[model samples]
Target: MRIKLENGKQNELISLAKRNLTWKELAEKLNVSEYYLRTDLFYEKRLLNSEIFTKLSKIIESDFSKFIKLKLEDNWGQKSGGKKSSGRLKKVLKPEKSEELAELIGIILGD
Candidate 1:
């Protein structure tokens, strides 16, 4: 239940949020207030509790740390480690593509 942030999860969360669920819906599903969700999404607050983080992980069907790291990376635009692989491929993914990818992630997660 200890949800430590990781790179993979953060990406997944962004993908999920962008594609499958709005931050409001996600917040409702997670049983947290919208203010907190915005804080978590916009203000870069790390979700520390295992229960809440676990709920989100379950919804996304991903590990908590990976999701957290993704959130951090998306919000902060900071690299997780060495070099980012996606340079040109990322350009190919337009807004629609991102939405599709997010949907796929949600489907895989069974949401």
Candidate 2:
């Protein structure tokens, strides 16, 4: 499962992990791409998977995993299809409107 640490703690952990190594060198040790390590994890931060987080903890000898917590993210994905207008709108609705509808139609028909 993907996990997240508190942002402050995660940044502290990343700083510790960096130590003297450049991101490219650190990524090489972790067998991942520097772009992913730098951009994905370091810059555009998101949930890190268990294995990667474990590796980082081991590499830095720092465990911030306890700071991690699960949240039910309702905003995680997109919702499709929604009411495009203010509902039934100013259009035909009930059978009682048929007389008004016919009058309106007659006006359009040039009657």
Give per-model TM-scores: 0.42, 0.58
Off by over 4 Å in 2: 71-111
Q: On a 0 to 100 scale, what is the lDDT of residue 66 in model 2?
A: 84
lDDT by residue (tens digit), candidate 1, 3-101 = 445534544554565367787787787677777666664343554455666666677676545334323323232443324544535445545558878
- Among all windows of 10 consecutive residues in model 1, the one with the lowest summed lDDT is 69-78
What C-alpha lDDT, on a 0 to 100 scale, does residue 69 get in candidate 1?
34
Q: After superposition, how far is residue 52 of candidate 2 from its true place, in Å?
A: 0.8
TM-score of 1: 0.42
Residue range with the least summed lDDT across 10 consecutive positions in model 2: 77-86
Highest-TM-score candidate: 2
Give the root-mean-square deviation of each candidate in angstroms: 19.6, 9.2
In model 1, which runs have C-alpha deviations exceeding 4 angstroms? 6-18, 65-111
The Cα error of candidate 2 at residue 71, in Å, is: 7.7
Each model's lDDT comes to: 0.57, 0.72
